[model samples]
Target chain A: MNANDPILETLNLVKEFKGFVAVNGVSLKLKRGSIHALIGPNGAGKTTVFNLLTKFLAPSSGMIFFNGVDITGERPAQTARRGIVRSFQISAVFPHMSVLENVRVALQRRLGNSYRFWQPENSLLQLNEHAMALLADVGLETFADTLTVELPYGRKRALELATTLATEPELMLLDEPTQGMGHEDVHRVTEMIRKAAVNRTILMVEHNMSVVSSIADTITVMQRGSVIAEGSYAEVSANPQVIEAYMGTTDTALQGAH
Target chain B: MRLTTYVYIALAALAVLAPLIGLYPVFVMKLLCFAIFACAFNLLLGYTGLLSFGHAAYFGAAAYTTGYLVKTLHWTPEVAILGGMALAAFSGLIVGAMAIRRQGIYFAMITLALAQMLYFVCLQLKLTGGEDGLQGVPRGNLFGMLSLSNDTTMYYFVLALFVTVFLLIRRIVHSPFGQILKAIRENEPRAVSLGYDVERYKLLAFVLSTTLAGLAGSLKTLVFGFATLSDVHWSMSGEVILMTLLGGVGTFFGPVLGAGIVVALQDNLADKVGSWVSVIIGAIFVVCVMAFRRGLVGEAQAFFGRKKKTA
Candidate 1:
């Protein structure tokens, strides 16, 4: 897509909690049909930025443009209806609900039938079929009837992704999609994210350098509530500030992984 | 199969056999009143994760209204009871608005405070007849056509209303709106992020629960032929919560079981030990919380769930 076709844009967005600035003067553009990676140090404010965009938190100052519309201070549900969906950093899937039921609830919310109460739930064949399709796409078809809390961590994360996808978002905000996972689990999730990016734009806050380098078309390095560097992985890898802020820290974690 | 369906079947069987049980119809009517109370209580604490300590306000308010309409205006039982339900719904809306401003323990405290205020109003109000209450309340006619003075007729009337309300609650729990409420209970922040208006959903649920509580109170007043301070007391609120906890908080039919068990215990033991019934409920609460968080039906479901897995 062209530069004019940006799906999401932040203009000098700032968020502060009391005296501490969680996200400061952060501005970024996510092009349509692209996988953009937001990389940072431990307190980089990447998740804060995601929260502001999704309307989970109001920005201290600035504007959020989604699909070329100003959506800065809209309610979370209003923003979600506009196709800006975010997965939680802590896997926000309903633990008491079955995997399929979780997806169906999201799907129902999207289809505008979430408020329908009089009819029997099983009578909604179209909704059920669509929910199953979403579950199948995320490789959770076998675990459809299983409670989300009973699922393995990797599967819970995948089910979370499936539930998010059920909202029919045009742009997905994933907060640390592959967090707390082994190499094989990371690989599986990276593949799933890559597959998901085929039809929808993804702005993900990822800590894993390997996953970022493998999948991100564009990478923005953030440090202490600001974008320190922005470019492709190869370009950012060569930047002195990015090298000192990100690579220096990532190398130590990489070595510690062994 | 869902345990709720089985419980419904069992309760239906009991209703059919009520006449052969050799029990007083008035006792069964009292049990039905508390059953509705417990179910209404469940809508908050069980499904919505809200702890309301002022349900007694709605329960007692409706009772007084129904008793006044029947005793003063000489209206039929049905009209008086419907008026009571409407009055309860209105009062619930007002109190629920204020109570919902606080959550968790604070929510319970707010409800208790408001209910206490209502209790004082009842005590001072002349229509409530002070401690004497509105006496000589004619059970009156069902629709100004069928007499409700016969205990059997009145028992079936109350039973039919109880079953209808119970089924309505079940339908609500299984609905999409109920699912969203559960999501709010499970993880509110996530539910909010998913585009649900968490506060609006909560307020709607609070209103619904309170309205149902009112209906039950109105029916109770008609059956007992008086409205007393007992229904409005904070202890009544505690009793409903205890029933829900004893039956199972969120599960369908749990509150019904809780209501029946608690009412039966009180009816059976109150004659012998008087007010010690509260002590026994407190003991059950402590035991249930410590060892069995699932209550009676919840534990049964869990047991069956494990068995199914093993099988």
Candidate 2:
């Protein structure tokens, strides 16, 4: 992978909340068409970085460049429209809507016809086939009619990814993609992420080193709002500073992995 | 879907027969106007999950606009109503733009403050007739052909508009656009990250809701031959919310039912209870909120849902 062909680059990013610095001078370069994982101790500001990249939270200082264009000042929706989509750490879906409608809403954005209130909803039925295909990709085809809130916890994360995929993202920012998932779900979601990463760049904050080791193309380790090390999983896990950051934390490199 | 047409027919038939069935056409027509207003508010509050405490602003603004247009400018009833609705939409755009910046209770407060501002402004403006209100707003001829001066004729005219707006609202709630609105209502941040531009959607819903509300307000002025301060008052805003809530927030005909119940209570009780009608309405609202928070339509739906599951 070309390290210089950065799809997303943050320059000295900082986010402060009422004098408490959440993200401090952290810069990251995501390679084009690669799965880059950011692993760090809890509260190391990995989620804040995701929020800043998606413009959910404004950076106190520094800049965000997407495909070489500065997108630091863009609104969250504007950032999403520019081919940057994100998934939340918690399962994020329209809980009252059926699983199929969840993806259809995202897919409908491409048609530019969601604003046509007069048109019969039968017009949206045309996109149902496409929505189901995305659902099938996520193994949610059987649950298409189920209201999203009825979905089990791990399944909701998959639905979030399915919805994220529906955005047709050029760059996907996933926060804790497999957080709180059981063994099987972690495996399924990890494989899904690997499958979904084709032709798109993914910057995910993952805690599961086994998952990272298996799927992540490169890993960036952060400590106290700063990057402690960056390289392949093998390289970063070997670094002393990276080990110290996760010393007291249950997650220490690939130690939790089999 | 077939059920809707039947429901509409049944509603129209009942409304058409109400005058002959011993109910005053004028009173029923007045109730219908507020029903329309509630349905419009329901679009934003029930469907979009936006609590706008200032909706009376659009309703009253249109009432005044339509009253002024017909009484002074001599515009046709339909065009005047449209003029009022357009103004309502414009004001909705501004109020919505500012209010949508905040969410939940903050959103409610912004709308309240804006509506109160309009209320006071209406007080000083000569166009609004100060506190006197724009009175003698003629019923005017429908298209300058069918005279609406007859109460029965005006009742039927209002019924027609009610049906149209009702169906229009139903269509919007079920359309792809409506789907986005519901998605925003369900999970706003998710809608935004999915590239739906939730703020723009919120503003659009707000404008649509307020515009329809204006239609109802304009009709009220035409119905009563006046647009008074009561129409623009903050209490009017609270009343619409009660109507929607009591009738079943978000249910298609809930606001209509809610408006009917509230208006009937006010009308029936006002003669007997006088100004204390407010106290009576307040008691009923408190009881409804405490007992069945879902409103009438919502409770019925829940009841039926439970029964179906059991059966």
Give per-model TM-scores.
Answer: 0.92, 0.97
Estimate, for each residue in B34-149, the C-alpha lDDT of model 1 and write its tens digit: 99989988988888889998899999999999999988998888888888888888887887778776878998888889899999989899989888777677899888899988
DockQ of 1: 0.58
After superposition, candidate 2 runs with Cα above 4 Å error: A1-4, A248-254, B1-9
Model 2 pairs in collision: none
DockQ, per-model, please? 0.58, 0.87
lDDT of 1 by residue, A50-72 (tens): 88988888998999888778998
lDDT of 2 by residue, B131-171 (tens): 99998889888898989999888888998899899999999
- Angstrom error of the Cα, residue A40, model 1: value is 0.6
Where's the lowest-lDDT run of ten residues in candidate 2 chain B? B1-10
Where does model 1 sit among the CAPRI classes?
A: medium
**Local distance difference test, candidate 1:** 0.85
- Candidate 2 local lDDT, A117-185, one digit each (tens): 888888899899999999999999999999899999988999999999988999999998888989999
